[model samples]
Target chain A: DTAVSQTPKYLVTQMGNDKSIKCEQNLGHDTMYWYKQDSKKFLKIMFSYNNKELIINETVPNRFSPKSPDKAHLNLHINSLELGDSAVYFCASSHSFGQRAYEQYFGPGTRLTVT
Target chain B: TQLLEQSPQFLSIQEGENLTVYCNSSSVFSSLQWYRQEPGEGPVLLVTVVTGGEVKKLKRLTFQFGDARKDSSLHITAAQPGDTGLYLCAGLKGSNYKLTFGKGTLLTVNP
Candidate 1:
């Protein structure tokens, strides 16, 4: 079984179009995160949630918003997307505190291309 | 902002060879982690080094954390073609609950 999963493995949309990506985890972890991997392969943390509460927001633009309805699910919504939004989005999960708290499990990334 | 810089942004080596990739930072990290990512997939954790000067080995892979806790390294011995992937180093500082990642080192192991 997949520990962490994402929908719409590949997305192609036009500029100015809004889109949303969904992520879910079954690892029974309390912390979840959203990351963006650019063309240069630099992975950056965009947001994190612990027990469904927002924990970290890395100065991302207002267009990108993350919502966690429950600890197991975290979704990302982008408004008025632009060309710069094209990148691979990844979802990850981990325990809040413990020996393995620092270890994260990531899902197969969703590649979004805005043209 | 805390940043981790990885050396030799790209490396191509042949099987049965040895290679080492370094991860350095100006700020100290409470813990450091190394992850390997394959094409079209998210990174997989290879090792995590928390204590200074700690060394952990995974089969043919060896990971070390600098005594200053500001750097780390991953060494692979007799690398195989299956070892090719993008290696990433991430650092967690204090109690921020976030990781600062380096650009990454892309390794291509040719048979």
Candidate 2:
């Protein structure tokens, strides 16, 4: 079983379109995260939710919002996507937050292309 | 902002050779982790070092944490083609739940 899974492995959409990427983890983890990997392969944390509570929010624009209906699911929604939004989005989960955060398990990334 | 800097952004080496990748930071960390990522897949955890001057080994891979907890290193011995991937280092400072990642080092092992 895939511990972490993401939908829409590849997404190609036009500029100014709205898109959503869904992520689910069966690891029974308490914390879930959304990360963006740019063309340079630099990974940055965008948002993190601990047990459905927002715990970390980076400098990401308001166009991007993350929703966690429960502890097992975290979804990312991008509105008015721009060309610069082209990158790989990865979902991750960990057993718990804080000190145990390093042992995160990541899902296969979703490649988003904004034309 | 806490940042982790990785040296030698790209490396190409032959099989059976040895190589080292370093991750440095100016701020102290409570723990540091090393992850390896292959194409079309997310990163996998290789090792996590939490103490100063601590070393951990996983088969042919050796990881070291700096005494000051501000840096870490990954050394591979007799690297094989299977070892080729992007190596990333992430650090957790204080009680932060997020990890600050470094720009990864892409290693290409030629046979």
Provide TM-scores for the models.
0.98, 0.97
- lDDT values, one for every candidate: 0.95, 0.94
Candidate 1: residue B50 Cα off by (Å): 0.6
TM-score of chain B of 2: 0.97
Can you write out model 1's per-residue Cα lDDT over A2-111, one digit (the tens) per residue?
99999989999999999999999999999999999999999999999999899999889999999999999999999999999999999999986988875889999999
> How well is each residue in A83-104 modelled by candidate 2, as lDDT tens digits?
9999999999996655555488
lDDT of 2 by residue, B1-111 (tens): 538999889999999999999999998999999999999999999999999999999999999999999999999999999999999999988766788899999999999
Q: Score the docking of each candidate (DockQ).
A: 0.88, 0.87
User: Which residue ranges in model 1 land beyond 4 Å of their true spot?
Assistant: none
